[model samples]
Target: MFNRFWSRFFSSESSDESTTSTKNSKPDDKNSGSETEMTETSNEIDFQLMPTGLKKLLNKVDLSHPPGLAGDICEDLATLEYRALPNLRPAAAMMILSSVARQIENPPYKLNLYVISTALTASGKEAHQNYLKQALMDLGLDSKLHDTPRSDKTIMFDLLYSEGCSIYVLDEGHVLFRTALSSRASTFEKNMADLLLQLKTAKQYRLSGNLKREVQEQLIARLEKADKKKSNTAFQPEDKEKLKNLLELTNECIYDPFVNLISYSVPQNVAFLFSKKEIETGLLGRIIFVRGPSKRAPLRGHDKVVRPSKDISERLKAISTENLPTESLAARTTLHTIKEYLECDENRNHGMYGAIFARGYEQIRVVATLLALESKEIDQSMVIYAFKQFLNSLHECETHLSTQSKTSIEESQKLVELKVREYSERHGSGSFGVIRNNIFKCSAPIRKLENNQKDFLSNTLQKFADLGVLIKVGNNQYLHKSCISAKKLNTAKKQST
Candidate 1:
């Protein structure tokens, strides 16, 4: 029903805008249709002609009687024209909503989203991040907020500290992930990406550090100390038993870790972040991309953000990890259907469309849960609004990637050959003891990296070994032709002399 209403609303709105020229002329009674016919014509709405995206949806919403703080906060940002794009404000708001609301217990899956927003530099990404930070601080939920990552372990520590959920809203966060795309990408970057993926779907991820062993050791020391001081009131018989039991359970790590990362970056930088491998691994599909305009957006003269409604503030304040609303069966079914439909597109067709749709149904439900607030059941209106955000996000991501050229990607692929040549030069033997840092030891420039070189920096070397230009010396290393027979090399030099 909401879909029909949306379709008709857009159709009627378009007609009104297009028919403005007819208003000045006299009405033609003969052409004017009956009221029933007019209603039928409006009902026969062409969905293809309907204008979509969050801005159009924002314009139609009335936030007085708020569904939840998510939509209301978006409306507030939109009203102030918060110097962010039409979609980014809500993306931030949803991040806040999901982060704060994650404390809500018993959802179909975790309520948090892996969302990324991008725009041109000086396009207010930083300013918007500050605004979001201030908003979170205003609600007294500052602990959940984190800055850019200093190390790979920083996120794990953040999740450990913030009750298993941390929100990092970094302005140029893509730079960290971009390193993982390079051939020289460190284990740390790859591990970071892997850790994020684990945090996304799996509940109760265990920390492998000495946290458990250290706690157990401490517990044992306390027990032995209590035994040494039999009279000490600190360790009674019952307390000893409790301490022993606690020692048994100290092997625990993060249980139900809710980690949320919302990054804002430009399109070019983001292009280097994900490749086809990342897509197949489900990382690309899991991420929600909200792309802003190619240029900065103009401010609406208001220097400050309009404060959100009292209910929104109060509602946000009242949200706790243990007090979130539970999802209804109707909500679950709709979300499941959405997931299947998106997965179908992914299986049948191709591209990053499935990537956005990968989280589509789940994200929509998360938004709906925000809009529904205390009303746990999913409704048609809430689904429509939530779907609007999803479609806008999809459109933004698709449009953003569309701007990335195939020529540039072809160029990135050329790095493989460069890396291979680089490997041969750095490890191969040369006549002089000096290292020719910029020299290519290989006579021919290959178009791709070999398997050994790609992983262990030895890519395929058997062909060179077969040609006698190089010899396989085990451990994925190659003995240079000069190294194979220094006597022959010296004799050749002697002949030249």
Candidate 2:
């Protein structure tokens, strides 16, 4: 049953790809700039994943090959042997856009994004991110790449010390959320939710006043060294300039701190990560959730890697922070269109999800700004393409994060129901001893229930009894109707035989 749901849910994911695959090989990537198109009225299946507003917005823009730098990047990654996995292609493309966007001067808006990827354990969720990192390192753009920061004050510390942008990768995202739940979490980690919210549109980062002491101490040491060389003379001209600059920076404002956050995790981590608080506070709404394939990739023969073509190499090398591309009129108009549609949730009608769609409006606008700054082409294709990806993320939030998102609670409920029925079948009665002492075959989700486990179980059982599936027979016992019927059928079968 689980496998069937996975197939139906993800059937369209692979339907767009080519069939040239074999067993024991990596995933395939046959998508091109040409369209695997979708229309506004197209309801491909009962489980259509695209949100209504985004789907309607698609009707206004072309759904063919992505235009400009974003499209070129998809092909570039494929050429570099980073073939698109289930949900990896779009994510890698977004990273490429982010890498270039971080370099430009972010005055009108910040292009920073927070991407959250969820997949099965060992399903290779980090494959595309790793591949993109390796490509950037090979291309000399690795200056912006880094692991997570040491502390909150030091979040953009490395970028400040260095002369480039920053993108932090958190490979073990599950551990991150687990720690967020801890009362002893670090100040920086605890502030992650707020940081993500503020940074999305922030134009400056307040310099930590405490950082001044370190700068002051360093300057003092530098002057002392220079004085020792001259023995009673003041510092050298170079030393004086260095000290002066260091002290000035401590007071300087960190404007346009372009930082991107990427994380990978399994489906089980969603509860600990988002929770009711994160959702209500708009943190989860800010994150772009990229879900990997429902089922494992088809096994195919391993192939040897190949060097990227010269055209792709030169294109990647051309990307730099030295200059910003001109924003296209069409792209700008499309962004405004998206803004108008999502703002105040006027036509979106997403209910409680309106806030999230509005946040996605901000995200898409940033992408349009970045792609324009990278491609310099006056086209709405990239803007349309970005909306396409955002639609998928929104659908994921609705299906996985909203309904049936709490696997722990679901597991406990299912276990209690199954055990009650089983016990009634054998002893013709219902008691707490059945589920209470049945921990021998318990799973992780069962043990992860809230503090009031006994009360929760009692409430659940009572709800089932009220529905007629279970009947109260005594002070602490109930009879499962389905189990009794099954037992009677078996007895009748035995007598007939």
What TM-score would every model get versus the actual structure?
0.59, 0.65
Candidate 2 local lDDT, 419-450, one digit each (tens): 67776766776465554444324544444553
lDDT of 1 by residue, 1-497 (tens): 32454434332332333332121121110111111112222212223333344335444532111245565666555554435454466677777777666767666767777778876776656656766776777777688888876545666656654666788878788876776455677665556777788888776777565544544666788789889988878768986876776565445656677877888887677876444466667776677766665445555465775555566677677665555455566555545555555556432244434454556666676678766554555565566557655654544443334334334444433443344345555666422112222222342233222221242123223334445545444444444554546776455434434
Worst 10 residues of 2 by lDDT: 30-39
* Span of ten consecutive residues with least summed lDDT in model 1: 28-37
Q: List the residue pairs that clash in candidate 2.
A: 22-300, 23-299, 23-300, 24-299, 24-300, 25-299, 25-300, 33-65
Q: Please give the TM-score that candidate 1 achieves against the real structure.
A: 0.59
Predictions in order: lDDT: 0.56, 0.57
